[model samples]
Target: MSANHLEQLREAVVKMNVDEAEAIAKEAMSDGIAAMIMLKEAMIPAMEAVGELFGEGEYFLPEMLGAVDAYNKCFALLEPDLKQGEFEPKGTVMLGTVESDIHDIGKKILAALLQGNGFEVIDLGTNVPSETFVKKAEEHSPQVIGLSALLSTTMSEMKKVVELFEESGIRDRFRIIVGGAPVTQQFADSIGADGYGDEAQTGVELVSRFVAAP
Candidate 1:
């Protein structure tokens, strides 16, 4: 497919026009486009644009939320129609906001970005306990586990969660990614996390690089 069609899909997603988004998605599929290609080339760019706009103050939370909703709706329509062997995920990611942190907007944005980029995300939602994160990781066996904590106080919870995984003997099984307002690369290093991102887009990029590495 030409880059123009991909750009059109991105624009539709930015506009939060569900009908237009669905039409473009169906068209892409009908044109024999690869699902992963569509996700990586079109949908992810669209959501990333929305995030950029939000960061630049050209868009607000409501618009960002709407765009994410539209993108997810389009994805739902296209997912079941994808050929069984044609959809190869970049990786599997389990994501959640750590215990005592009720702030979820950042976590939700990260989830959307990850899913839009072809990672199969298992979102565990807000205020997730450290034990629960370890338990879920054991059950799902994802390639990466993402923890978010917007509050400084809750950041310690990420360390405890890492400890839980270590105690479970599965610490080496998954790459540990930590993020949110209070999280820093130094903090991540101190806690023995594999990666740290200060923002949602950075998190997405970090995960992509981690999964793509040899």
Candidate 2:
């Protein structure tokens, strides 16, 4: 029964059937299955498969966008169950588009991917200031903070976020990850970011790795 439900869940996500996916998530919750088990066994793997298809050009932006929306809908349905059930979060993550940058498509995808993979995500919406990021980090104490900047002019704010962490003497408290257009491995290194993801899936993979390690 559980296996069948999981199978259906994966198909729903792959097909970008938001209603179907949300129904299945609610159904699993009613059946007393833990939220994390449903996610790890079905939803997360489904998104990974979607990512693979996208990477191979078998899926395009519109399809990927639909799939991501479906995934988020399913997660929204399961969120209450996740909080009320015995599921353990992989790790907490803080995410946002840095100050002076308003773009969010990639960052939003990364947030969904992280949440689907069992990470607790604190999403600070686009154009977040460095001071806000640091304060939130101190408040949430997450394992990682992801910064996004879609423009070269705005990219410097990512470094300022890191500097605020340093000034607060909490630089070691969390891992800093940077991404979005105009961001690169070298730019990440230059900004003193702990990691860089050229794309959303890579960002998800990096966060997964960081959370899985002791």
Candidate 3:
């Protein structure tokens, strides 16, 4: 593909132009561009740039959310084609914001990052109960189960999920990963979480490593 076409796709993503982005993605695929190449060369870089801007405070939550939404639109067009091929996920992850915490922005970003890296994420949404976590794990048999808690008080809820897993005798079944603003490595260790991340990117990486490990 020409540099211009690639640049157009990147610009569409950065500008949050969902329709244009999807069009560019479909056009790229029709031109015989590889889906993984489009994802790595175009979409992931765009989202990474947005994430950098977010870290720099140049882009706020609204901008980040808009960019993610646009990227999802582009992915929606490419995903069907990719799924038709022999696509193996990097890993399977089950994610949720723990009970009593209604915050979702962090969890949503984590989901996007995981998807960008080729993990199949099953998001359980906000205010998820401990039993739900165990039940979903039983159903999906994911490699990693991620719990998010933004509130200091709700941090303990991560422990509740862990306890529930132990009670179900499936604690050894999957690695439990935890993250959020109030979460720390120490806290994760204390709560019997297998991993902890300080940011969305790190959280995705952490799960990737845990799942990839033999």
Candidate 4:
């Protein structure tokens, strides 16, 4: 419950100390600090800071992956408590890495942050085909669908997914967003995607806006 504990937890996450982060989360839970508080105050902010550093080129993929791992460790400890608490999810989000793109660090980070921000996330993992996205969207009816592609070669798969959704007459049923290392806002626009996230934090914000829209 003490502010110092929160600060330590935050530092542990930012420093990519996975074991220490999980230990601190457990300690906070034992002290009745609440899962949501640790999430909103320490863990989320730590990842946001990591995102900022990544944007500034002070951090690289390995650093970001480490931070995500640390965050995941802490989140795993708190997730059950978060689910049991009095919380209503803001919306449902379905995420996956587009076909041929086996990379999923960005998608994983986005999924964790979405869950922390009170969105129910269905992460479909890497190498997801266009038809699979449409199939899952139909099955889940999520508010937002996020496509990720780390390689420029796989970026076209995102457009294919969007086109298939449109062809299925369900494109308008959900907000479609795209992102990854090689994805740009212009690319998203050209693919008819509703939005583009340059990073994990931006992805969460974009999804938030889509779900909050009238």
Judged by lDDT, which candidate is best?
4
Q: Write the per-residue lDDT of candidate 2 for residues 95-199, one digit (tens) a residue.
A: 999998877756766776676667888999999999999999989999989999978999989889999999999998889999986899999998798899987
Model 1: per-residue Cα lDDT over 12-71, one tens digit each:
999998789888888877888766567667887887788789889999989988898788
How many clashing pairs per prediction, in order?
0, 0, 0, 0
Estimated TM-score per prediction?
0.64, 0.62, 0.64, 0.67
lDDT of 2 at 171: 96
When 1 and 4 are scored with lDDT, the better candidate is 4
Global lDDT of each candidate: 0.83, 0.84, 0.84, 0.87
The predicted structure with the larger TM-score, 1 or 4, is: 4
> Looking at candidate 4, what is the lDDT of residue 199?
76
Between which residue pairs do clashes occur in model 2?
none
Candidate 1 overall Cα lDDT vs. reference? Answer: 0.83
What is the per-residue lDDT of model 4 for residues 127-206, given as tens digits with 9 covering 90 to 100? 99999999999999999999999888999999899999989998889999888878999999998999999877898899
Ranking by TM-score: 4, 1, 3, 2
Best by TM-score: 4
